[model samples]
Target chain A: MRHTLRETWTGLRRNLTMTIAVIVTMWVSLSLFGAALLANQQVDLVKGKWYDKIEVSVFLCVPNVEGGQCTSGDGATQAQKDNIRKVLEANPQVQEVYYESKHEAYEEYQRVYRDSPVKDVLTESTIQDSFRVKLSDPQQYLGVVEQAKSLPGVQAVLDLHPVLDPLFMWLNALKWGTLGMSVLLLVAAALQIGNTIRMAAFSRRRELGIMRLVGASNAYILTPFLLESLVAGLIGGLLASGTLALGVYFIIIRKAATSITTIMWIGWHQAFLAMAAVLVVSILLSVLPAFAATRRYLKV
Target chain B: MITFDNVTKIYEGQAKPALRGVNVDIDKGEFVFLVGQSGSGKSTFIRLILREYRPTKGIIYVAGKDLSTLHSWKVPALRRQIGTVFQDFRLLPGKTVYENVAFALQVIGRPTREIKKVVPETLDLVGLSGKGKRMPDELSGGEQQRVAVARAFVNRPKILIADEPTGNLDPATSVGIMKLLDRINRTGTTVIMATHDSTIVDQMRRRVIELDAGAVVRDQREGVYGTA
Candidate 1:
């Protein structure tokens, strides 16, 4: 064991440049891999938090409403609003219906658009009353929407899917894009590791030949090379884990979590999982290539 | 002991065989010389005994184990009982003479205590006791070859195969190496050497096997370098 370790150190030191190249490549690729995993987790969290709260807003006609639905030109009466609510409640797809008054709508608009100039242009009378209908299955919103749109006082029905689809699509693209890039880099790292092992084996061919002549087993001859790659991979994995922890702490926890409280961000627990995955992937990347390269280059 | 029964070897992508069908038997503690021109199958014969190459036909038995039926994993175990030396005196350039010799025992998993005792003794036996700390580059060609010899004999293998061990040395230096092998063979270790050094072969008067075009042309009990 001592001889093997000593030989491993000798090999690493002799091929110091190649060893560093392997480690750096592994570190960057493994970090990207961990980031891709965390991005996927973040996308799932955003989807879970927002999908549960999606509701269809059925806006009733207001005074002097223009365009298509509000042709009556006068505000919807209480009886007209009650008739729309009844229709929505009768739909099996609609889980619950709540009437939002014009005053409540105006207050929500003010709260949401507090820093926008549009908030100053809207008043309580200008806001339309609406029935916020929650569906048993959010994917079945179209059925409830068509029923509410044909109701007596309904001006228009809005299904939040249109607003949320693009956001989810962008999130998904970011996740998959990160994952694709990580896979490419992982391949690059593996190739670099293979090249490094080949060079090390070439430089030590004399020692390997002598060892073989002395009756060294294949495993005995190969242990030092394997150990060299293992050490580099372990260091790269540790660095990647550190990078992942720092990224999660700074980008998600400190920045996104603090700014966007509505969505749950991945915590250290999930980061740890991603970090563990990075370590396993990095080790596999280094060790497998080294094994293959040695088998080809080191005949013993 | 070694036996070759109808052994023939043809390398891949080659039309001609390196060794033709031939049979020979060597008893224990024998010192035999294999003499042939280049490509006459001297190296091939030694490689077969080391299990480095499998015969394309027939069988070779070394130390009572059949080379054709030997498992690939068991080749190393078979090699541990045999020591090999090359024409180039294959020694680790960076290691001292002592470390180079110790490496042989170390790879075979010999205990450090035994290695400590055996390495110096073997170095002394090969006339390199006080020069253990010298590197290969610092030594003469003959001294480097002696270091190679010490490493090959450190494990005290049952058989020693030297493929032109003195191919790079002066006649005087070659004589010193021959004396060392002679001393080793007297201790009951079989020594088989393949060489083109006619002077050394003539001086030794040992069993000689001569090959021509991968076929054994002559076998003599006590022979000179050529027919006389």
Candidate 2:
């Protein structure tokens, strides 16, 4: 162990530029994964913050129907509308339902487009009434949806769960994509490490040969070099984690959070842990290359 | 003690063997020079001892281990008993002379205190005592070769394999390196050196194994470097 360390320290000292290059490469690889992690975390934070207030919009039918959603009992009958109102008011999941009559609907449409020319093309006679439902929480929509589907008077039900659905879906894709990119960068770092070790071993071929002749074990020959690689990788991981944490804290959390204070704040502890995880991963990936390069290219 | 019994080596895609029916015995504490021109079996002999290349048709024994069956796992163990120095020196360009010598001990997982004593002492033996911190490039060819020699002998190996130790040095420097090898031999370590340097061979008057076309044609005590 003492021998291995002395060798590792001396190897590191001798190969300064190569050591720096390895560290930089590892840092960049880890940082890419870290950024993607932050992005996914942000998306998760947004979804968690907003999912509690998911709403459902239930459109009501006209007295004599004209928007072409009236075929095959498709539009709500009077009985169906009455049943929906009862369900919304009594269901444990429902917080409240504000019924929009045709008049109220027309007024909202006008209010929304008061300055637009499109408002002149529509009147209250042509507008449809609807029930605007807000749930106690978004997750309750599953139970509420099952009940709403069987209700009579509802013409259509639109749950706000679909809004947060895209958030999770996109987050999933981004996390995996970032993971793939990190793997590619890790491969690049390994190859670079291999090349550097090869050159190093090649240059010291005589020393290695001599050592072998003297009955020095292979373990003695490779241990120091392996340790050298581990040291380089660890240092690189630390640098990468540091850089990523700083970027997340300043760029994503503090600066972006300033404009999005209504959303959520990412704490320092979680960020620190994430970077630490990245460091561990980078260090693990580097060991094999150190072994392979020395064994194959630098073999005496 | 080592023996090469009718050993032959055929590399892939080569029609002819690198070594053919080569047979010889090198006893313990003996100093022998393997002499041949380039492309002769000089390198093949050294490699066989190191187990870098195994014999194709015969058994070669080093320290009682049949090298033909030596596995990768057993390699390091085998290497610990023999020290080899190559013609090119093969010094780590980034390392100082001290570190270069220390690396030999370090790789085997030696203790720090042991390496501390061993490294500097080895350097001093090679006449680089005060030049320990200088990098490989900072040293001359003779000094670099000496470092390689010191590394080979640091473990107190049973055998020292020097394949053209003075290949890159001047005549005087070559004499200095040869004398160093002689001193090492006097300490009871068997030495096997491969060289084409006729001047050194003639001067040493040691046992010389002359190779021609991958086969030994002459083995003599107090022999001169014979023609290929």
Candidate 3:
């Protein structure tokens, strides 16, 4: 064991430049991998926050609007409005149905268009009463919209999917792009580790030959090379973890979370999970390639 | 003791065999010399004993164990009982003479107390007692070869194989290495050496096995280098 340690130290020091190159490559690649994982988690968090609040707006018939369900034509009566509410409440997919009176809708319009010239043209008389329906599963919004469209005095059912789909598509693209880049770099890091092992084995060919002649077992001859790569991988893993922590603290928590207060951001728990993944990947990347390279070079 | 029974070795991609249907035996406590020109299979004979190459045709027995049937994992155990020295003094360049000698014992998992005791004794036997602190580069070619001999014999292996141990040394230096091998053989350790130095072989007057064209041309007790 002492001999193994001494030999490993000597091998690492002998190939100091290659060892450092391996560590640096592992660090950069693992950092990117961790970042990709965090990006995926952040996208999931954003989806959860937004999807929970998604609503389908069911607009009622207005007085002068020519609509199929508005045969009475004086506007939807209280009886028709109550009937629509009962039907929505009875649907299993609907979580909650909120009734917005004409006055409430007019107030919402005035606040939303406070700076627009259209606010002067819109009034309580022009505004239509609507029911904002929240569903247990946002994916079932189409069913709710179909059911409400067939109800009495309902003019139109508007789903939020079209308004929100483009934003989610952009987020999904960013997540996968980061993940793809990380995978490519990880492959490069594994190759670099293999090169480093091959060079170290070549440099110590004399020592290895002597060991083999002296009846050193295969494990005894291979342990030092494995340990050298293991040490480099450990250093790289630690550096990647540090990079992840700093990135999450500075970019996600400190900047993005503060600026975008409505969206939920990932916490340290998720960051730690990503860091663990980085460490596992780094160790596997370094040790497996090193083993293969050493085995190839150790052949007498 | 080592015995080769009708052993034939044909290397890959080669029409000619390196060794063919050769039969020889050297009992324990005997000093044997293998003499041949390059590619006459002297090296192949040495490699077969070391278990580095298996015979394509017949079986070999070393210390009464069948080498052909020896498990691959047990090769190290087989090698541990035999020490080897090569043409090049294959010492760790960064290590001292004492560490170089101790490395053999260390690889075989000998204890520190045992290594400390055995290394100096073997170095002394090889006439390198005071030079233990010196590095391989700091020593003369003869002294470096002495270090290699010390490492080979330090583990007290039953058999010692030397392939041109004195190939690079002057005659006077070569005689010194031969005397060291003679002393090692006197300790009842089987010593097999391959060399082209006829002067030393003629002077040593030990058992000689000569090979020509992958076949044994002569095997004589106390033989001279040439046909006599």
| Winning model by TM-score | 1
lDDT (C-alpha, whole model) for all candidates? 0.86, 0.79, 0.86
lDDT (tens digit, per residue) of candidate 3 on B1-228: 999999999998888999999999889999999999999999999899989989999989998889999987788888988988877988899899999999888887889999998898999898988889998999999999999999988888999999999999999999999999999999999999999999999999999999998999999999989999
> Which digits, one per residue and each the tens of the lDDT, describe model 3 over residues A88-145?
9999999998888889877766654443346678679978888888899887788998
Candidate 2 C-alpha lDDT tens digits along A1-300: 655677688888888899889888888888888767776666655554224444777776555553334444345666767778888889988988777777887876665444334666767866767777778886667777667755655556667567656756776787888778888988989998898788778766766665665556767778778888899999888888888878877876669657864445454645776787887787777788888887786564
- Model 2, residue A291: displacement in angstroms? 3.9
lDDT of 2 at A266: 52
Most lDDT-accurate candidate: 3
Question: What does candidate 1's lDDT look like per residue over A1-300, in tens digits?
Answer: 998999899888988988888788788878888888887876665454224465798888898776435667787788888788787788888888877888887877665444344557878988888888788998787888877777777788887676667866877787788788888887887788788888877777787787787788889888899999999988989999999999989998789878976545677867988999999987888789889988888875
Taking the true A–B contacts (Cα pairs closer than 8 Å), what share appears in each candidate? 0.71, 0.63, 0.68
User: Which one is best on DockQ?
Assistant: 1
lDDT of 2 by residue, B1-64 (tens): 9999989888779988889998899999999989987888888888888888877889999988
Best-to-worst DockQ order: 1, 3, 2
Q: Which stretches of candidate 2 lie over 4 Å from their true place?
A: A1-25, A38-158, A166-187, A198-232, A239-273, B85-151, B164-187, B195-208, B219-228
**Native contacts retained by candidate 3:** 0.68
Question: Interface RMSD for every prediction, one decimal?
Answer: 0.9, 3.5, 0.9
